[model samples]
Target: MARTSTKRLIAQARRALAEGNRSYALMLLREAHDGAPKDGAAAVLLARVLLVQDHPMAAIEMLAAHLARNPRSAEAARKLSDILASVTPVTFSRVDAAGLAAALRLDRVTADPLARAAGLLLAERGEAPAFTRGTDESALLIALLEAAPVREPGLELWLTARRRTALESLAGPAAEQDEALLAAMARQTWLNEGVWPVAEAERKAVDRLDPADPAHCRAAALYLPAERWCPGRDGGSDGMPKALAGLAGDIRRERHEMARADADLGPDISAADGTGDAVAAQYEANPYPRWGWVQPPLAGAVRAFLDRIAGGSGGPQPDGGWAGGPLRILIAGCGTGRQAVEAALAYAPNARLLAFDFSRASLRYAAMKARRHRLDAIRFRQADILDLPDFEPPFDRPVDLIECIGVLHHMADPFAGWRILLDRLRPGGLMYVGLYSASARRGLTALRERIAGERLAGAGIDPADTGAIREIRARLLARPEDDFERALAESADFYTLSEVRDLLFHAHERPLTLEAIGAFLEGEGLDFLHMDVRPHIAEPFAASVEGGHGESAVLDLKAWAAFERDNPDTFDGMYLFWVRKPG
Candidate 1:
C-alpha cells in the first residue's frame, strides 16, 4: 500500500499495456488504484481499461466512486463526463436509476454532459419519469433547465409539456412563489432564448398575472425575452429576489461584456476586406455558437494524442529538422472560444496558442470564458484571416499547428484565405481544416434555393432577427415527416438563434468537393494525413476502398470521394481533415 509500490504497479501496468496484454494491464492498474485510491493517473487508467473491455457501466461506476471520494480529481471527472457524452442509448439501457444518480453527483462535470446522461436515461425509461424534488434526477433537471444551451429534444419536450400543464392549472394569488416545477420551467425557457413555442392561453394567463408577483415573473419568463421580464424596474432589479438573481446576473454580464468588447476590440481588428466585413458583421451580431459548458480534455501530450487519433498510420511526425518542443498553435477562427479553450486545456503549459476571430463580440466571449477557466495558455485577438500576414512579422517562428474549422467557407474567396493560413504553418507542421462538402449539402442547398426562390420570410429577415428564425422553425416543424425541409428540425442548431443564422442564413458560404480539395492539397505540395471521421463512416469506406489498408486507407482522397459519392450525406456537417506541409 506504500506510494513506491503503487507507482511500480502503475509502471507494470503501462508495460503490460504497451505489450498488448490488456487483461494483465487491467489487473495491475486495479492493484495500483486499490493501493492509491486518490491517485488520478491510476484511476483514469483503470477506468479507461474498463471502457476498452466493453464494461462502460462498470467504468462509469468506478469513475463516479473515485470522484465522490476525491472531489478534487479533475481527471476522474473528465473521464466520467466523456463517457456520459459518448455512451450510446443501448449503453444507457444498462444504467439504472442508481447509476445515473451516482453520475449526477460528479463535481466539475459540465451541464452539457450531465444533461446528455439525464436525457439518455429518460430515453431508456421511455415515458418521462416522475422527479422528486430532492432526488438527483430532479437536481439534474433543474441544472439542465438553468444552463443547458444545447438542446436535448426528448428532455425539452418533456419539460415544455410539463410547463404547459403547470400553466393550465394556474391558481392562487400571483404574488405567491411558483412551485418548484414552474420555477424550473421558467429557467429552461430563458436558457433556450425565450423561443419555446407558447400557447395563446398561456400568454393570456401571463397577461392577467400581476407583475409584482414572483409566480407571475417566473411565468412571464417563459414567454418574454430576458430584457422584458427583468426590465430593470428599479435601477436594474435592485429589489430582485435572491432566487432570480442568478438569471438577472447572467443577462447583465452578457450585455456588459458585449458593450465592453465594442470599445476594447484592440488594434489588430482592422477593417476587413470585401465579404470579410459582412461576415464579421453577422458574427458580431450573434456569435455562431453560445456554449454553456466545456468538457475538459483527457490529459496527454499533444503529439501522442494526435498519434492515437491517427490510428495505426503515423501522425504528423516531426521532419525538416523541426524539434518536438512546446507547441505553438494558431486557431484561425475560434468562435466563442469553445475549441480554443479545449485546446488550451488539452495542451496546457506545453503549448502557446493564439486564437483569433473576425468578430470582436466572439473574442470577448471567448476571452471571458478563458479567464473564467483560468487558462492563460491562450491569447484571444480580433483579427481577420486575410489580415493575418500583415500582423505576423516574417522573422517570427511559424506555428506548429493551425486549426481552421468551419471558418473558411464563409469568406469571399475561401482558397485565398486558406493559402494565407497555410503560409503561417511551419514546414512539416499540421493543419486541421473543416469545410462544407458540396456532395453532402445538396438538401440544405436545395432548401436555401427554395427559400430564396419563393422569397420566404426568412430570406429577407435580418440575420439578427430571432423572431423570424423562430417562425421559420415553427413552419419547418409543422411540415409532415416526409417533407425534405422538415429533416432540418433534427439539427441541434435549429434550436438556437445564432446557430440557426450560421446554419442557414450566412452572408456567404461555399462548399467544395473532395476532389477539388485533394487537387488543391496536391497543388500546394501538402500530404493528406488523415480525415477526422467517425468509425462508422471510416470503417465502411476503408473496407470498400483499397481492400482495407488498415488506417492508411483513410489517406486516399480518391476513395473518400467515391465513398462520399455513394453516401451523399456522409460528410453532411463538414469534411474535417488533417494535412501536413511537405518538408
Candidate 2:
C-alpha cells in the first residue's frame, strides 16, 4: 500500500477502536502491518494491540519477523525485546533448541536485532551462554541477567556462575583488549552483589581510558564508585573528555553531599515542614531521580509520557481548554524536575508550568538540568505539596492541570496532601497521581521484613546513603540466593546505587488497594478519568467500574481494582491515573 493508504488504514483502525469495535480495529492494524512490515510504528502498534488482547506470543512472532526484515528499527526491536522479557517462560519452552542456538549467534554488539533478542530471551530463561574467560557480553545480555531473576525464580545459581566466570577473566588478554567492557561488567556485577576483585592492571586500563569516547565514558562511570578503587586516578589523573570530567566531578560532589550532616541540610530540608523530617532528610541526602543529562548522554527523550499527553494528537485537552486560553500545569513533588521540564517543553506555546519540590538540593539539580538543556519553559520552587495554600502567587494560583506523581503516598497522611492538591485545582481541573499498589508490592512488603531480619536494613543506618545500601545489597547478594533476589534485580533502580537504595529501601511509603482508592475518590467527589497503560489492560476494566458499561465507560478505580485481582502487576510501580473535580 502507498503511504497515504497506510495512514488511512491506521486512522480506520483507531476509529474502530473508539467505536468499540476491537475485532475490526485488529483487522485494520493487521492490514497496516502487512503493507509496511518494515515500518517500526506499524509493526509496534499492531504487536502492542495483540499483546494487550492476551495473544503475547502472536505479538512476539509479528515483531520478530518484522525485526528480521528491518534490523535497524530500534523501536521495533525494543518492543520485541520487551515482549520477550515478559513472555520468556512461554517463549523459552516454545523456542526449539535449534532456534535458540541460532538466536544466540546474533548476540554481538553489532549483530542483527534477532540475534540480540535471542540472547536476551535465553538470558531471561537463565541460559545465557557460559561466561568464558576473556569473552565479551553484549550490554543487552547483561541487562537481561539483571532483570531475569524477577521473571524466573532460582536464577541466582546461574547469575552467580556467570559473575564468577566474568571475574576470572579479569586482566586476561581479552580484558587488556576490551578493558572498558570488563569495567562495565564489574559495575553491573557489583550492583548484584558480586564485586569482582579489581586487579591493578584492570584498574590502570579503566583509568587511562580517554574521556572523549562516550561509550568508554559510560563504562568507566559505571565503575567509578568502586568500593575499593579510585576512578580516574592511580597515582595521577589522565585527562578525560570535558563531558566525562563534569560527570566525575558530579559523582564526587554527590558523595560529599550524602555525607553531610542533617544540620547542614538547612531549615527546609532538615526541619520537618509538611512531610516528616525523616522523609525530607532521606531525599535531601540522595537528591532523587539521579539524572546525568547535563554532562553527557542527555536523555534522548525526556518527560516521555507527559509529553505524549500534552502533544496528544488533535484531541481534547485534559483541562477542557481545547478551545480557550493557555492552560496552567503544575508538577507537584517534581523530583529533580524531570516531569516538570518535560511538561514545559511539551506544552509550551499552549500552557504555562510551575514545578516545586520539597528538597532544595533536588530543585537545584533540576534547575541545572533545565538550564543545561536551555529549557526556560519551567520555573522551580522549593515548597511542600501539603502547603499548597501558602504558595505565593502566581505559583500558588489554581491550575488547570496538576501532576502529583510519586509523592502523596510517602506522606504521613496521603489524604491530607491529596486534599490540598485537589483544593488548589480549579473546577474541572485534571490531576495526575501515582501511588503504590498494595497487591503489586506484596513482594516489596515481604522483602522489607526479611531484609530487616537479615540485619541488612535497620536502626542507625540511613537507607538514603548509596554506600550503605550497596553494602547491604552486596551482603544480601553474597548470601545463598534466596526469595528476595528477584525484586532486587528487577528494579531499574538496580542500575545505579542511589536508585537501588530508593527502590528496596525508603524512609516512608504506603500502598493503596484499588478498593480504597475507589472509596477515596468517591469521598472526595472526584472522577477517575484515564490511565497510561496498554489499552488491552483497560479493555475489561470498563465493565467492572461503578458506572462502566462498555469500552466507552470512564476508566474507574473499581474496574482497575478488579483488573488487578488477576493482573496483580498491572500497576507494578504505582497506579498512575488522572482524575477531575467534575464540572
- On lDDT, the candidate that comes out on top is 1
Score every model by TM-score: 0.83, 0.62
Cα lDDT tens digits, model 2, 303-354, are 3344343434433344434333477878888977777766666555566777
Top-scoring candidate (TM-score): 1
lDDT of 2 at 151: 24
What is candidate 2's CA lDDT for residue 111? 23
Model 2 residue 120 lDDT? 44
Displacement of the residue 72 alpha carbon in candidate 1, Å: 7.8
Cα-based RMSD of the predictions, in order?
A: 4.5, 8.8
**lDDT, candidate 1, at 266:** 56
TM-score, cand. 1: 0.83
Question: What is the Cα-based TM-score of model 2?
Answer: 0.62
